[model samples]
Target: MAVLGCYINMVHPVQAERRKALDRFKEQIRYARDFGCGIIGTETGNVHAEIIYTEENFKEQPYLDVVESVRELVTEAEKFGVIVGIEGGVNHPIHSPIVMKRLLDCVDSNNLQVIFDPVNYLTPENYMNQDVIIKQAFELFGDRIVILHAKDFVIENNEKKEVPVGKGLLNYNAVLPFIKTNKPYINILLEETKEPDIIDSIAFLKRIYYQTV
Candidate 1:
């Protein structure tokens, strides 16, 4: 099981709180091997004290803050041979494929990698272009991605509202084919999907995965 150190806000606007979060994340990195997991996953978070959506997170300093925090985590992870798998979202600093690519370039460490969740990257404004976005992510950092989060979403009131996998707008065809070609056997974690739905989601993914050839 991978360590889900996903709550720490890597770009907290407060310096002290940010440091504390980093320390806790480092602690997780140090002990991940004991848990038989090599990778610890997290999101490049928002700038505000509260983890809410804000346009300010799309600015330069929050992105820089994430870079700094990730670099530190990567350094600590390298010593323990743990990988830091960072996920991006529309609401956070590393908000898209391009920004995620920039952070990867800036960190420049093999210990630093991606936990790609296509639904997390989707916004109402961009969900319609998901095929393009998914293609961009694979083209940019498919090799860097160590985990995939499987979920789906529906558009409601012009917002992207998440639902169980295989019950919404995500195109597994766009995702699983790439996984089959370039990332076979990679771990796919189900996000916010439960019981009976989980079984169906698995069946849905397997059907496409086997047909991708």
Candidate 2:
């Protein structure tokens, strides 16, 4: 289950650049099988072309822009028999579980699915409440989830900071049990990890992933 990381800013502020980005994404879709990959994964992007955090991303227009962008990508993916895996984050337009659910509904294409990253959703203010948020995500779109991005985060100076899977505060217990039960053998791609940490992260995930329910 190889997934090509074709990450790009789908909602680029400039129309010309946005079209070019989409064209490049479609090209990846066309050549996905050549790389022995059936899924092309990306984060639903920010309104800023620079990919920085902005309050504008939370507005309606950016959300609609992401919907249109994903629809276009899904159309190209459908032709190539590839899956378009969209990921959401705090900085992007499709920022929350409810927003992601709406995007999934509006796109309404079988080719469009999710690459869920639980750590990406955590904020300093909401980190303590992640159990509820993660559970809501599974309840809302567990069936649509195609991949999982594993990482951990900690709060430093009242801001969220990313770290390797087992080195920080992300509760894999909230995630792995659901994967074991519903999405057996699903790919859990690790991010924000380094050498010694990567090995420990994989071992950590395997331990929880194989735990009895």
Candidate 3:
């Protein structure tokens, strides 16, 4: 079995408590290296608020905090020769392709990378134009994407809900080709799947994979 990466959970926002989180992240990096995996993944912890990213909450302070924290984590990850993959989303501090690019530029480490999940970056305003968002993600960070997550989302009752792959509105038709042409060997992980649903999700992704080729 291929273990592309291991995830590190978010830590508490308190400044004093960040040490423990960094220790755990370092441990995960070590574990990934020992297991022969090249990547370790995580979301930026909710440092400023529970739901970290919002129009009002999106500011320079929080972004700098995340960038500083990741800079330290990348230092540790470099020791293990493991890439640190930050998962971006609308809820996290690194919310968009522009922000992600900024973080990468700030960190300026090859060991730092991205775990691309297109659905996680969507909002109500941009969900309908997801093809453009997906394209932008690949265009901006394609070289840094270590893994791609396969999932779907829908706007139900004016709330966006994640569903099984191919069940929701994600356009695998666009996503698949981008991955095939740019990062053919990147791992595609199926998220939100149960034991019974795994088979169908795998089948759906495989069909898309072949069709994209």
Candidate 4:
């Protein structure tokens, strides 16, 4: 039980009721705070299934809806003195670095921060430019990152699939330095890995992490 933070499923179907979602999130905040956890993490809602990244979808009302919902969640988080971490991805409303920054600025709360997962932002077209994307994410949300998600992505059948930290396309050589330099005390949570591979993933991450720093 090394984990001192809890990741809340804020994108469930029941979250469609925005008020209920906010209430549930606030309750989770209290639960985390009472249990000695300092952070409560969640992702923005899902994107349009048919067209994930479209100009119209980005400008749609749903995006603004998520923003407003997060703003309310952050306000509640402030009262509990627990951090509300938002994990953004290409399939969610806070998709890009720009949108992430915008949300941070809009929320304007010290308790509101990011749970960064680089693999979530990677797309087939931007896979080659991963260095740029990773750098931009650190630069834009560096001060706002409270937790880091350790995972990797692979292209199978022309679709992205999550894999263990070192088993896929993520370049830890580049990512580790950014984390070490900018959020040195941040917690790195492993995801998308089998239980048997957790130890190996942690060892691999620690090896690169120490080597980078």
Candidate 5:
């Protein structure tokens, strides 16, 4: 069964009520572990701006605040004995896979892992580089990929958009081969599930996916 690792903000920035969010985050991770959810991932940081890539005053990418926030998540994740994968998305400056690499290298925490979503690194001008992007991601993250945001993406009118797994620019069939070669142990977590129904998502992956016979 696909475990829903809630991507919604687990940590509310009500600095006064720090324990509230921390306690909730702990409960969710413990829930994941109790249910045998092999891995879970989430964004440890965000910007207040409405725009996806727009830089904010204090919450810029590689924000020190993010590191501090992750430290808290790390402490909670230890009890569940689950690996917490820190993701790089449009809302973050750690947009590239290499930034994920840098964070892993810097903190050197055994409890943290990578949630590879290669298309998040795509810029307007560099939209045609999914092949390069995915390859670079595999090279950088390698076996540390704990989970995959298994959805392809596109830039339409400069806004990021999600298309189906096999139909869009994601090249899921080929992409999975590379990911399997580099990080076979990691689960291909489905994200960007554009289908309105959960059943639709299962149909999509059943048609084109990485599996062993």
Candidate 6:
């Protein structure tokens, strides 16, 4: 089944009145489960919790709440028989994949897993051990990976911008061989394929994926 993710803002800093937003996120996942998808993925909190090892905005509440949010969703997702994957992405507050592993350990839900896209963490400002970073992520998350995001990055305006997958430096076509070798049945979710070309990209990915199998 194709995995679809939604950032329902399960945990956002909306004072206290908007508390219902978290439940709404859970409902969205329940609906996704009804549609026959085995997994529903989510991005971490909008504020990069201190997990990235940056001293900026390193507070205890956001750190504790992000885990609580994942736990709540995963608990409900288990009732629906759907797995939940928390994505590690670009510009995310919890940018380090290793910190993500630690958070996963704290939640430790049966329905919880990882959805990864390594290039999302890539930034031109700091090369910061890219290969070792990826290898370590796989070492920690290989077993829990339930979905992959197919996004590529390019340096633009001094920051990474999303570009079409095959056109960018990140290697989706090459990554395929590795993913299938490790986790043969995991779903690959494509993002940021311009509206005009989404159909083509999905079709192209299917062709390449099947050819390898």
Best by lDDT: 2
Clashes of 4: 0
Tens-digit lDDT string for candidate 3 (81-101)? 888889888876677888898
lDDT of 6 by residue, 50-97 (tens): 234343323555556677878888888888888887886544545677
What TM-scores do the predictions have?
A: 0.97, 0.98, 0.91, 0.87, 0.77, 0.80
In model 2, the clashing pairs are none
Best-to-worst TM-score order: 2, 1, 3, 4, 6, 5
- Where model 1 places Cα greater than 4 Å from the true spot, the runs are none
Query: What does candidate 2's lDDT look like per residue over 80-167, in tens digits?
Result: 9999999998999989999999999999999999999998788999999999999999998999999999989889999998888888
Task: For residue 205, give model 4's deviation from the true position in Å.
Answer: 0.8
lDDT of each: 0.90, 0.91, 0.80, 0.77, 0.64, 0.70
Question: In candidate 4, what are the lDDT values of residues 1-213, reduced to their tens digit?
Answer: 223444333333354554565677778877775677888878776544333445443564656777777878888788888888888887777788888998898888898888888888899878888889988988888888888888988998878888877889999987898888877877888888888888899999999989885
1 or 3, which is superior by TM-score? 1
Candidate 5 lDDT tens digits, 1-213: 344354534333455444565566667787876677756667644454233445551344345556656677777778778777777865574656766677677666788887777666676677677678777877887677777777766778986677766556666665667655666565676666655644666666656644622
Question: Which is better, 4 or 6, measured by lDDT?
Answer: 4
Residue pairs in steric clash, candidate 5?
A: none
Candidate 1 local lDDT, 19-134, one digit each (tens) = 99999999988899998999998887778888898999999988888988999999999999999999898899999999999999999999999999999888888889999999
Note each model's CA RMSD in angstroms. 1.0, 0.9, 2.1, 3.0, 3.8, 3.9
Better candidate by lDDT, 1 or 3? 1
TM-score of 4: 0.87
